[model samples]
Target: MKAAVASALRAARRVLAACHESPDGDCLGGALALCLALERAGKRVVVASTDGVPAVYRFLPAWERVTDRVEGLGSFDVAVALECADLERAGRFAPVLAACPVLVNLDHHRDNTGYGHLVWQDPQAASVCEMVYALLAELGAEVDEPVATCLMTGLLTDTGSFRYSSVRPETFELAAELVRRGARPDRIYELVYESRPPSAVRLLGLALSRLQLSADGRVAWSVVDEAMLQQAGARWEDTENIVETLRSIAGVRLALLFKVEPSRVKVSLRARDGARANEVAARFGGGGHLGAAGFVARGDLEDVVRQTLQAAAAEVQTGSG
Candidate 1:
């Protein structure tokens, strides 16, 4: 870890950061967390994402500086990719990885392929933000208010507000510490969970309307197509919350949400109880936690629907208690 940090500090004097497309809570939170930390180290920082930052995160410090394409992004001495497994997950900014002298890939996904020169993939760490926290401490960097806000947001979202099994005692302790450092839980919570446009609420209603149950009622599935999105006037970002309602019904152990994109289908997989969702997602080269994972599917929506439904059924039968 010392050698890794040494290499990081040497090459990270001027740094750029990238996250996955259609950024989720962890993706944006982790990248922003590290950018703020690196900036505090007196390094130049440029953070960009292909899918762009969602409105919920616009309040973060230096959030406005994030651009879709980081021009001269290759000129940075080092670049960091967060919360992404594959290098291709960087989308257009992928070349920035090769452009820099050093790359640090940090993620908690089980399927991470060790893409960066300095790789830290700990699936047990719950979130990439946790690994970043450890990295900051390894450098003996101070956790000021900006750093605390970004890290706290990362931890809060990835663990579902400390309601998931990943929430260890240490996680709570860290939360308290962040609060001590001036991270306001109420404001962030309201931004993440409560605030949403009216169109998103309508889209959520439509998604729930399409919810389907397994023959035994142990699995639930829902699909939201582009047409449905257009009808409801919902942006692709608005679909983030569509998956949770699928698992709300009693006895449902597995939930699936299929979001149709322009070229492919994106699948969100969630498990209740002790199911292993990351394993289920890895088949398609995507992953997350045992309870919440995602994958991108090729071909048509029907193909995606067929494959996901089949895979989900097998998981339900085999994963049954």
Candidate 2:
């Protein structure tokens, strides 16, 4: 699959590289790194994201090149979807990708639906960046300083600073190689983790104040509504990492953070070892890694929370037994 994707990319003169809607570090980093590598190969690459780059990720190399609009960009010889479970995960850009003559799906999600003409997926991968690194080698593209920094962001963020169980010996070896190529892990850590605004910190406090645990203490959950965002002067992106915090509580098997939108509630799920957070997410038409997943449901925030918690609780109990 890697060879097939590399061949397609080499053959294409104009390529569209895209990540999922509300992309996190993995998708954005992998896409940008691929974009830089392809450009070096003499291909015209356009990187698109429906929600655009979040402030925390603006430090990535070539971050400014990402455009939220792709409709007016004309046709592409091929489109590459990075870290997207399915084309619909591309948000408004799904149709544009579907229309492309050739689509390559490069992802690391366990529940990937396999939508593209050529698919390369590995659930064990710490991040799609790992796959991207391999692809660059296959294409004989140099991992310059810019490319190294981009790939390193994906590795650090997706592995929770290498704290997650997904990290392997190869993951560390890749990090070392990237560092030798000029990716500064210390700077990346400070920028992505330690540079949160005061508003975001306030939002985190508000969410933590409302954290609730199930009777059995296996499920922990909280909600952040529009009112909280307004009160704390926080944007939706500020809610990042709140679910992981919840999962860190003692005896907690599953953690859920619900962000209440005007018409829908976006729930982020995180689970400890043995708990299938992705299964709970899949129950609601969402999917992700075993330890992390999410879904959006259109309903009252309270109602959605109730339904999701019920599913999560059952999973926790089953895992415990």
Best-performing candidate as measured by lDDT: 2
For each candidate, C-alpha RMSD in Å? 3.8, 3.0
Please estimate how well model 1 matches the true structure, expressed as its whole-model Cα lDDT. 0.80
* lDDT by candidate, in order shown: 0.80, 0.92
Candidate 2 structure quality by residue, lDDT tens digits, 173-218: 9999999999999999999999989999999999999999994999
TM-score of each: 0.81, 0.85
Tell me which residue pairs clash in candidate 2: none
lDDT of 1 by residue, 1-321 (tens): 535854676456787788887776676766777777777778888887987888888877667777787565548777788877788888888887767788877788777888777787777776677777777777777888887888788888888888877777777877898899988878888888888999999999999988888738877889888898889999887887778888778988888898878888889988886666787798789988777899998898888788777777788778846
Angstrom error of the Cα, residue 165, model 1: value is 1.9
- Identify the leading candidate in terms of TM-score: 2
Residue 309, model 2: lDDT of 81
